[model samples]
Target: MLKLHFAPNSRAQRSLWLLEELGLPYELNRMEFNPKDLKSDEHKARHPLGRIPVLDDGDVSIFESGAIAEYILERHKNGGLKPAVDDPLYPEYLQWFHYCEGMVMPPVNTIVVHTLLLPPERQDETVRGQAQRLLTRALAPVNEAMEGREYILGDFSAVDTMLGHAIYMSNRLGCVTDEMTNLKAYVSRLETRPAFQKAMSA
Candidate 1:
């Protein structure tokens, strides 16, 4: 059986959602989202950075949600979540799958650090504002792409699981503004997914 080291309200939720979507039986090693729990030697052994969403499958251990999601799909024959390499959509799939972490999450994480992670006195509103602007700019293309599309690739795929988390995080941080109607609608569609709901509850 697969085993996952998870923490609530962390990127690990993406892995959990993937597992649920795949209906794969796995062990959940839930941990606290704090240094005492994540920074311990035991946890560090699984991930040098002590990050959540570390997956253990027999002798194979891996970290990072994007890699984990791909690992799961590759092992499970894409689990109907990935486009076949021969298919033309495969290239686009790969782009959007990585885009969540590469383009969107940078600013989203910046906002998180400046707004939630940093101490109140140390938190910089200026930094947060800049991140908000960057986030808006980063999502503009996505908003445009979302026009007349329900999902990133016009079908719910693993990419949605990854991007959904970033969008959800941005929304929670108030970085998702009212003018982002397309994104707001996209969020609504993602929120209605049972897999997304189950993951969020975790």
Candidate 2:
């Protein structure tokens, strides 16, 4: 069985959601983000940066939300949460899968760093505004792309799990609005999924 190291209200939400969607039997080892807890050598061994959402599958250990999502999807492609490699939509599926990390995360990270992670004395107004603007711009294409579709590939797949997290973050940052109607509806649709609800409540 898979062993997942996770914590609530963190990136680990994505991993948990994926596991639930795949119907994979996995052990959830919950960790709290305390100085003493994260400082332990064991935790550091799982994640050099002491991040949550690490997956220990027997002898194989993995970190990073995007990597974990991909790993799970690939390992269980027959579970119906992923597109087959030869499917016509496979290329777009792979592209959007990676886009969650490559395109969406940078601006999100900037927002986190500028708004919450940095000390008040070190926070830069210019950086915050720039990050907000860039994040908005980066997400505009997604809104446009989703205008006619209920999901990224027009069918549910791991891509939805990936982008749903970004959409959640955007909503939290007050970056979503009626102008992003399709994107907003997409998120709402995802929230209605049983797996997503389970992950959130877990």
Candidate 3:
């Protein structure tokens, strides 16, 4: 059986949501969000960085939520969420899917580390401010693209989960505010998905 190493409110939610969307049965190896569970030698064996969202598929173990999502889609032959290689939307799909990690998360992670992860004494206002600004710039295009669209690619796809996770995290940091009407609506739409609700609660 497929097993997912997960922690609540982590990037693992992406994989969990995708799994639920695929309607596949998988084992959830829930763990606390702490060094004791994530940084342990046993967990490290599954993921070199000892991060959450490690997927163990029989003898194969993989990390990185994006990679794991792709693996699941490919392994399960569920192409519904992904555009075919020959499809024109394929490039756009790849772009937005990767944009979540490559473009958005850097600033989001920076803000998270500076504002939430680190102790108040160790947090730096300058860094947090810079990250917030960068996050704003990163999300502007996303908000614009979401105008008149229910999903990133105009249809419900895995790109939603990939980019949705980043948007969700940014919202938690107060980055997605009322002015960003499209994003706020987009989030509301995503939250309405049964799969998204299942993944979040899980």
Best by TM-score: 3
Q: Model 2 reaches what TM-score against the true structure?
A: 0.92
Model 1 clash number: 0
After superposing candidate 2, which stretches have Cα over 4 Å from the reference? 77-79
Task: Write the residue-wise lDDT of candidate 1 on 127-157 in tens digits.
Answer: 8888899998888888887789888888888
lDDT of 3: 0.90
Candidate 2 Cα deviation (angstroms), residue 73: 2.1
The estimated TM-scores of all candidates read: 0.96, 0.92, 0.96
Each prediction's whole-model lDDT (CA): 0.87, 0.82, 0.90
Name the candidate that leads on lDDT.
3
Candidate 2 per-residue lDDT, tens place, 117-175, comes to 78999999998888888878878888998878988888788878777788778778877
Q: Candidate 3: which stretches are off by over 4 Å?
A: none
Predictions ranked by TM-score, top down? 3, 1, 2
Error of 3 at 168 (Å): 1.2
**Higher-ranked by lDDT: 2 or 3:** 3
Full-model lDDT, candidate 2? 0.82
Sorted on lDDT, best first, the list reads: 3, 1, 2
Clashing pairs in 2: none
